[model samples]
Target: MDIDWPLLTGLIGLCGVGLLLAYSASGGDARALHSQGARILISLLLLGVASQVPAPWLHRLAAPAYLLTVLLLVLVEAIGAIGQGAQRWLELGPLRFQPSELAKLAVPMMVARYLSDRPLPPTLRDVAASAALALLPVVLIAAQPDLGTALLVTAAGMSVLFLAGLGWRLIGLFGALAAATAPLLWFYGMRDYQRQRVLTLFDPERDPLGSGYHIIQSKIAIGSGGFYGKGWLEGTQTRLHFLPESATDFVFAVFGEEFGLLGAIGLLLLYGFIIGRAMHIASQASDGYGRLLGGGLVCTFFVYVLVNIGMVSGILPVVGVPLPLVSYGGTSMVTLMLGFGMLMSIRGHRKLWPA
Candidate 1:
């Protein structure tokens, strides 16, 4: 199988950096680091398997994959395990996994499948059908009260639409509609805790010991890091356990506090390179499905980085979005690797004309 070495290199670099930061954030404990290592190995194996699958098979499987995920989401509401005050997980004997993560992959696949054969710019009916395919998963996810995952899943499908020749006017209209509905979302759609998060974004100090604690501590950790940082394993906020979710959602704060501003920029540059490579692959895609799937995955990856960093830096409300490939989590890592593997599948399975 053909390999995209630069993309793999970027992924490996991020995973390695993630391990180090996770270890540091754990106060020299090797448990999280070790778990991350195992996850990386498994993720790579999955990537290999996915890379060998033909694009046509993926296209054919899209409908079934999406339908299965939809069923899982419904099951989640019925009998799923609850954690962090949300029913987002399915428990089966010894295995537990989030159905919402499946939507991340399936939504894009189905959107691409729908638009691959249809001529675009899509007609109004086509747009409505695509929206139904996308919104069904998004609405189900929001019902679980997992806003971050919901938004990401929605973006995955929207990215496909955007790449499928959605018009600029439609884009602007959607943007305006979303803005107009923001207040309604805040009042009726969002949970009380979620609303508090938004309010805290403007002034975290107002409730330093309540809903605002996380961002407040995050800002402290980041700002405390000077030019070259306080040195690895020397981040006071993380070591002292003052930072919340340091090894997961706020791992960037651990990185910043220890490596400083320069290191943060370097991390961003690494992510930028990864996204750039994905976009390049998308540009070279052999079909509409490949193009839309690749571009959507890349866009979703961009949002992961943007949301995680934005929340940590106090620029956006605190959401439980983990740093892509850099945060400690098995599900997120595997979900992302699946996308990358599909990307490689497209690249490797393309028909090459004789010179």
Candidate 2:
């Protein structure tokens, strides 16, 4: 059977743009550009391999894979490298990996597998059971203080349970409880610097040279791009080093400053197509498992795009979300490819097995 070329092509196109933007964003740092080129090649190779794997195999491995990631997360906390006030990465000689990215796929896979044939309109017992499965990793990651990824992973897992028929009354109750507890989570749950990030989202002018500077400068860079950007590598905000996190969390600002609104909108449109196609695949899947797995993966993919762009453009508070395949990181690329692989796995094997 022929693979769905559009989804594959769309992902490749997004990554290609990411490489170009990464190059321009880095101010001709030859090392970064060369490294990005190599990473892209590796990512493509992984994508190809993942595309051929079976969904059942992926489902089978979910529990073990997720447990491994959790163990690594806990291990990282115990003896991980500390950077920027958080222990989020595990050093691999020349590489730094984040287990949280792996959790993005693992958590959803485990949940989809769990709820595959459970009764619709879940019982409180099911909801409680599912919540336990979902929150274990969330609590661990949050302890690393990577709130951005922790939240995204939670959303992905909850999406599956929602598909499994989590009660709306329960959802609303959750919403209210989350809102009420947000204050305590804010004042006590968040570190001082994290609290600063939320405050920076509002009045960036308060600390023009501190936590607020990143957002303020990002806005300036995006605004300066206007209709036709400053031209690749010519972005003053990034090339001149005004925009912090230019190559990572704030990568979107660099893209806008160099590629302009047209480029920005074009990028958004590409994401729209990729996500739309994933949703289409989910809808067409043969069974409850296939459908929930595909749909939940789609939501996870969309969150990667949304959080990166939103945080960079100042729409959402700054979160350390990478731009899926675009951002520079091993774990993000691996997790993203795994998600795409699941999509491919679902599409590739559906014809052979009965739902």
TM-score, every prediction: 0.97, 0.95
Off by over 4 Å in 2: 91-96
**Each model's backbone clash number:** 0, 0
Please provide, for model 1 over 1-355, each residue's C-alpha lDDT reduced to its tens digit, 9 standing for 90 to 100: 7879999999999999989987898888889889889999999889888988987788888999999999999999999999988999999999999999999999999998898879888876787799899999999999998999998998899988988888998889889989999989988999889989999999999999998899999989999998889999999999889998999999999999899999989998999999999899987877877888889889999999989999999999887899999898899999999999989888888673111
Candidate 2, residues 297-342: lDDT per residue as tens digits? 8888888788888888888888788887777655677678768777
How accurate locally, in lDDT, is each candidate?
0.91, 0.83
**Candidate 2 at 249: error in angstroms?**
1.1
